[model samples]
Target: MTTRAAGVATPRRAWLGLAVLILPVLLVSMDMSVLYLAMPTITDRLDPSGTQQLWILDIYGFLLAGLLVPMGNLGDRIGRRRIMLAGATVFGLASVLAAFAPNAGVLIAARALMGLGGATLLPSSLALISTLFPNPRARATAIGLWTAFFAGGTALGPIIGGTLLHSFWWGAVFLINIPVLLILLLAGPFVLPEHRESGRGPMDLPSVLMSIGGMLPLVYAIKEIAAHGPAPIPAVAGLAGLGVLVAFVRRQRTLAEPLLDLDLFRRPMFRLAIVSSTVGMMSLAAMSYLVGIWLQSVRGHDALSAALLGLPGAIAVFAVSMIGSRVGRRLGTGRAFVVALTVAAVGNLLLLGVGVDGGVGFYIAASILIGIGDGLAFPLVSELAVASVPPERAGSAVGISETSFELGNGLGLALLGSLAALVFRSGGDFAPTLGETLDDAGSDTGLARAASEAFVSGMHVATIAAAVLLAATAIVAWRTARTQPAAAVGVSAEPVGARH
Candidate 1:
């Protein structure tokens, strides 16, 4: 086995291993959105209640977010490859179960199992990259590819789902994972190297429980509030989650082998990177959700057509992600982030001009701009987070980085989505969402027009809110990057591809 040393170049085997690792990364991200087009079909067949349908859609993400930290730490203690392979096996089996599930409850259970597996896949796969590419510049390039694939997977989910549902059943989406995962399982042992920290003690069960208890309730509360406004149950759950998380942090500080290392946050760059990532992802998720609704509800496009319309933006994201690190090298990481975020902010601002009647060209332009910005920012944030820590602690760092992303996605949907919903309700006696409003409006042309106008108003407000947030984040990133030198941030000062 070759040791990962600073001066060493990345081997051909490492590139081969990266190809192997990409399979699970792609699938894990795709699973997050693959159900969007299939949901109506699923609902019709399973006849689940409104709440049950929501659970079926949401449980996977909730469980995945809740378990990421614990699983990351677990991978550190055990072996990243081992955890990753086990996760793939479970994910594959769960996909089979979900594909064949006859009832809503069974499907929900299977999705939850898939979440459990996904938690392992994301962090372990990212951390394993550190072992494969020890050179910081090469590592940055590899991480850029990783980020690209992940973004591509997420963007492709709807298109792929729409295509699958065109001829096949809703279950085909889940079944498609089987063959890809089978490849991962077959080639993983031969190509991927195992990595674990030496001399780590047993995991703290209480910490694991606390993290799960804290995250699940918090995430669920966020989703509930976004869906149905502030209720007593979600309010209490949110508060309780916060309390437990505070306790969890304290316990980590006191532990000999903490589940999460709090000291990592001591580095200002790491903290800033996390914040940037969170805000970037938040804007992306909120915009994606809003735009998807707008296309189907207002523009009256079918699922496949809407997805196709959005394809160029997705392609832009994929392309920018691949070159993000190279851009960072030219401009320097800090300035690069400023430029990227500012561009995204501009994109969000463009959405304010879109009207209920027509703005297809404007919307497409906005999406491509947003895609460029997010694509550039995401990879750098991941590279910075991983580079901020020692190799042995990479899994934990990746977990934290990824957790920020998950939380950001949830928060964007909750906060911005709720804002839009509130605006829609205030305009008239409209339903919480545009879809429901149109469904209720039916053949009443006046009501439909009114509802459409109100929904567009809500979208504008949400879009502006997203824009303001991005701009504010950009200013903060600029200031922070200036104050904190690259070396102090646990990153090398040399330009990308620089060698000793």
Candidate 2:
């Protein structure tokens, strides 16, 4: 173990290391974007059924989210850099496999493998920053950069994929990953220092299995319920998942060395931070999920144009996140979130005017506002989540935080997005999904126009629901901030191994 002055400024080497850490962030996000943009192409080539296509698209996120906590714990137990390097290796190989798969099943298998590799990369990269930047403020800034780059990769994914798909095959998008992974593999161990718990106990297999098992079914249940309305099996699966998670928690309470230190939630600050992050991310995901479809399916834009529209919002997130720490210092984390959420609420409200008519201006305005709000608030919550734990246990803590973000993506799509679908179909007969609804309206100009109008109606409902959620979150944050204890320590100078 090593120690440093509590207030020591981050060194140049750590900045360099931060650059290396952003690779996985970009890789995972870019991969998501490319997959999304390449879906039709994949379906065309693989000729998968609707269910198989859904699995192909979602399995990556599902497995990645499910394994995050365990993988984060694994990194803490073994070593951050080692897992990072290993994850990158696996991710690169999986990309190659996915690029040239013989069939849908093989591609699904390859995507699941990519999910494991993604799970390893995120928590390890985030936790490594704790070791690198001992100062709380510097760490927040670094996280801001990480968030910005993540937004950049996501925004670029579709753009890049569209370009590649135009000139080459869908595999070209996967090939783009090869160079990035090669660079990360070569630069990582040389630049990023290894960090892990010094006295980790025996590996806890039950908890590991429980965590993965608990998450997989729960997420699948949520997605299925959203996609197909309430059903007996998913509802039962959800309950069963709840039971497994309860058991997992019970075992953690009795274990000498818990896989995740459940005690961290004891702090009000940590708990509040997690909630804020989850809800904030939910808003972001719901926005992207809705607007992406709204643009293409409703507004009659190409995927490339829709991707272009998303770029401004992504840029706003990057700009605001980079400066978010300063905003937090001025307003306090709680107030910063409140303000950001209000902005987000307003952003959502602006989109209430988005319709089958000419309201692209309002949509674009809403995009910038939402981006600004997320930029302002996202770092504050994430920074607090990372700061709440000691660097030695950083992987697990950050894993929980990261998981909350993934949960937001899952739940936002399920809850708010589903509600919108329900509202749209309530008035008349409609297809199961927006894409399907529009696709079924093929060649009938009136039906296409009517479908767009109906989808916009749903979009309005979703955005309004989103706004209410953000407003409620802001109020809760206000109360929490008022009562938050000042002793909420983000980090300490205890002899954690110094990043060399």
Candidate 3:
């Protein structure tokens, strides 16, 4: 029989483990935003080419996507805590290296290392939560906390970065990870339980390689297309990547332990959730990145000012998301998803009115809408994704959903961000007075500011694209919601306990 604790004792270890699991999410989301602010600072110091700049930005997500499955599988085989701690350690070290790096190339390399570490961190942490919290109510509550961290991180990045920038430099943004990781390292071993995969199958090496080969090239090609329109290199790379992906799927069909279980998509709810999440990310992620640049570069808002504009969204997300699970239960999950998507599309359209001349109020209002939309949509989508699989395969399914999120965010920024850059460069639009003033600080600052206009324009392009994609997704999800059988899917109205 299981031992029972007396006198209202809660499991401190499990709660601490859950906190450790969220550390990576906090770091990754914060860093992603901080870099958008830091880009102007980085380019001023480093003088990287436009392409190199995109690489520095896109590589982090690309590498994260490329390695997530294999690393996630490895963690399952070895131990989730062991893998997560190892990842945290690597990430911390990479951050220190990035902070002190002298050249752009070194910094880019360090960021890539950080990405690999991040891939390990996300899947392992998610799987650990799944393993720790087996009860549905506990799992929902735990996942709710996890979702809260994501929103918090997204909102907090600029505040932290702005503070750091005032006292230090761009590198400080990276350095901040060290202290967080150090704390995790000390606490993790003592508090987090070790859990290992119970299944028996060889890790599929060939499938892993094909997945990496296919995804990275495709991501790279897409980034290139965004940067340079339909360039030959991107064209060839895109075609090659697609072909490799097709072959990878074919190989997965025969493999005993496939890196990604393709059959998961056969479930209508799972398929719809992934598709909707991708489109959501494609829209929201692009807008988030672009909005930062537009605020700082075009509207001349400081880091803190730009972050403040987003405050309404963050607050709305926190407040609205509290009601999301209930709403999902009330409306039916698919119907709830449709409603959320529609609201989000409207939010994106609202952002179209926010121009360089618009007052701060407009931007803030737009952010609130976007935040509410996302707040409503993301959790529902996550709920649908998690509920799609049997409890036994939950770990793997969570990894897939996380992978989609990371890839969607990366692709949104790369493709939409790049298109904005190209449009601005082609138009030759820069604020001469602002350019002169920035130059007065130094030549580095001048070049950086000059690049800022293109960046802002790029952001606009991304916002527009995001809006279009979200609108399309809303239509698709609404049409598709009719087919889902209510009996096959269960909605647990009761509160979930810790996904420890």
Best by TM-score: 1
Give the runs in model 3 whose Cα sits over 4 Å from its true position. Answer: 1-12, 390-392, 429-459, 485-500
Model 3: per-residue Cα lDDT over 1-500, one tens digit each: 12124332335556777888788877876765667667767877886766777677777877877787788777777777888889898898899998988888988899899988888887777666666665555555566666666655765676677667767888999989988888878988887778776764878888888888998888888877766668888889989999999999999788766778777676656666777767776666667767766777668787766766676777876666656666666776667777777777777767766665664666677777877776766666555545655544445566777777677768877777767666766654432223323554365655555565555555566666777777777777676667653412234321111121
> lDDT of all the models against the reference?
0.81, 0.76, 0.70
Segments in model 2 whose C-alpha atoms lie over 4 Å from true places: 1-10, 33-54, 101-106, 135-137, 162-166, 424-431, 485-500
Write the residue-wise lDDT of candidate 1 on 1-500 in tens digits: 33355678678899889998888989987887777656656766987765566577667767877788889989988999999999999999999999999999999999999999999999999999999998876788789999898877876777787778777888999999999999999999999999998887899999999988987778778767776778999999999998999999999989977888777676666666788778877787667767776777788877678778778878988899999878877776777788888999999988887788899888889989988998888787788767766777788878988887766765776677667766777889875555666767889889888888887898899989988988998898788778753533235433211110
Candidate 2 has an lDDT of 0.76
For 185-238, candidate 2 gives per-residue lDDT tens digits of 999978899998877676799898998788778867876776678999999999
- Candidate 3 steric clashes: 6
lDDT (C-alpha) at residue 483 in model 1? 79
lDDT of 3: 0.70
Ranking by lDDT: 1, 2, 3
Our model 1 lands, by Cα RMSD against the true structure, at: 3.9
When summed lDDT is taken over every stretch of 10 residues in candidate 1, the lowest stretch is 491-500
Give the winner by lDDT.
1
TM-score of structure candidate 2:
0.89
What does the lDDT read for residue 198 in candidate 2? 76
- Candidate 1 achieves a global lDDT of 0.81
Model 2: weakest 10-residue lDDT segment is 491-500
